[model samples]
Target: MVVRTEWRLRQQSPRFKPQRRQAVSLTSRWIIGLLTAVYLLWLLVRTVGQPDWLTQLPALVSELLRLVEIGWLATLLVLWGLVWWHERQEAGQRLPPLKLEELYNLHPADFERYVARLFRQKGYKAAVRGRSGDLGVDLVLTRQGGKRAIVQCKRYRNTIGPDIVRELYGTLIHEGVSHAFLVTTADISESARAWAQGKPMTLIDGPTLVAIARSLQLSPPSSPKAS
Candidate 1:
């Protein structure tokens, strides 16, 4: 009886929200294409075989106008199809952003993957340097029109201080790169924050990182409960 009651309640519950509008089915599209082809063939036969059809206008002018209209319609349809395909390919390539809960659970290696994905979305070539002998750098990002940038991801639970920031500032020299970024899940000390001002490197704390993630159209991080 309890199981039966639960089943009844579940049946009354709302369905899962669909993420995207359903695409037209292959069969439906094929049917439409077939009908359009048949219609075009019929029009061609009528225009070619019928001598009195263009009585109001020269047959050449009527045929040319019909051809022009068909060309315009075909061009529009091709453009529309290309746009749809590009958008679908782009949507598939994007990496979903991390939630706060997920961030808190991520290992350092996974954090590097997350940051690398963000750079990828922005059209930068970014590679994780790995945990061993990374020389304090997690990601090395580069693009043709941009500077070669080094990223250090610190997924610490506690506050990261100035020492790490200074270390990353020094890391650029060792890596032979001009730009460096210190990305962390934890907040920074005021002294560290102040020290970063006017420096060559940038420090991104948790809140700022979340803002960046949102701006990139990645999944926005969920707010964590007050500690």
Candidate 2:
């Protein structure tokens, strides 16, 4: 199954990587704009109050205008640089599907991302929902024929138990998905494997995950550039 999407891969800049905060950038811009306006107003009022107001108005206004231009230009440049830095950092951190040992080293959120990418590479439309309050579903996978499956990723050394498998089954029913996938970095207990048998569920352990990663001919999904 070769799942297809509109994303294309781009080379990442290796210089720097930073976490992005869109709100902070927007707030900074607003602050600069407000300060610029107040400064210009103050300059105008000070010029008007001078004894030879008319004589000095031209020079004062010209200087004020130039100052505003320079301030705005510098602010814009700094904002652009911040945006570029964050984007580059994100791009640089996109790792290819590698060894299971390497997968074990990833943050839990990053592990979810890795699993989503893995499924996408295997021809499934996968979306990551590994956030707080996301229910038990981590990644939702849709097949070409419109069949849907929900995935739960566990990236830890703890053995997967029947309870977890059973919980995913309940989630599968609730979500109305056709199947459930429980991917874990550790081994699945015998009871857990037995519980999943004859059910619409698949358990992927560390070895199996590593095997899949090794077999893949990766064409990673594109990360949209910040506007």
| TM-score for each of the candidates | 0.54, 0.55
Tens-digit per-residue lDDT, 1-227, candidate 2: 12222111111212111212433544565775676676666667756764565455788786886787678667766866775575445334444445665666555665776776667556566666666887889888877567888999998798899999999999999999888999988999999999999998999998888777656645444432221
Best by lDDT: 2
lDDT of each candidate versus the true structure: 0.66, 0.69
C-alpha lDDT of candidate 2 relative to the true structure: 0.69
Q: List runs of model 2 lying over 4 Å from the truth.
A: 1-95, 218-227
The true-versus-predicted C-alpha distance at residue 227 of model 1, in Å, is 40
Clashes of each: 0, 2
lDDT (tens digit, per residue) of candidate 1 on 1-227: 97786455434422221112222322344555675676577667767866565557887898896897687568657755865575445434645445554564554565676776666666666666756887888888775655688899988779988888788878888877767888888888998988878876888888777677667774432222221
Question: Pick by TM-score: which candidate is best?
Answer: 2
Clashes of 1: 0
- Report the alpha-carbon TM-score of model 1 versus the true structure: 0.54
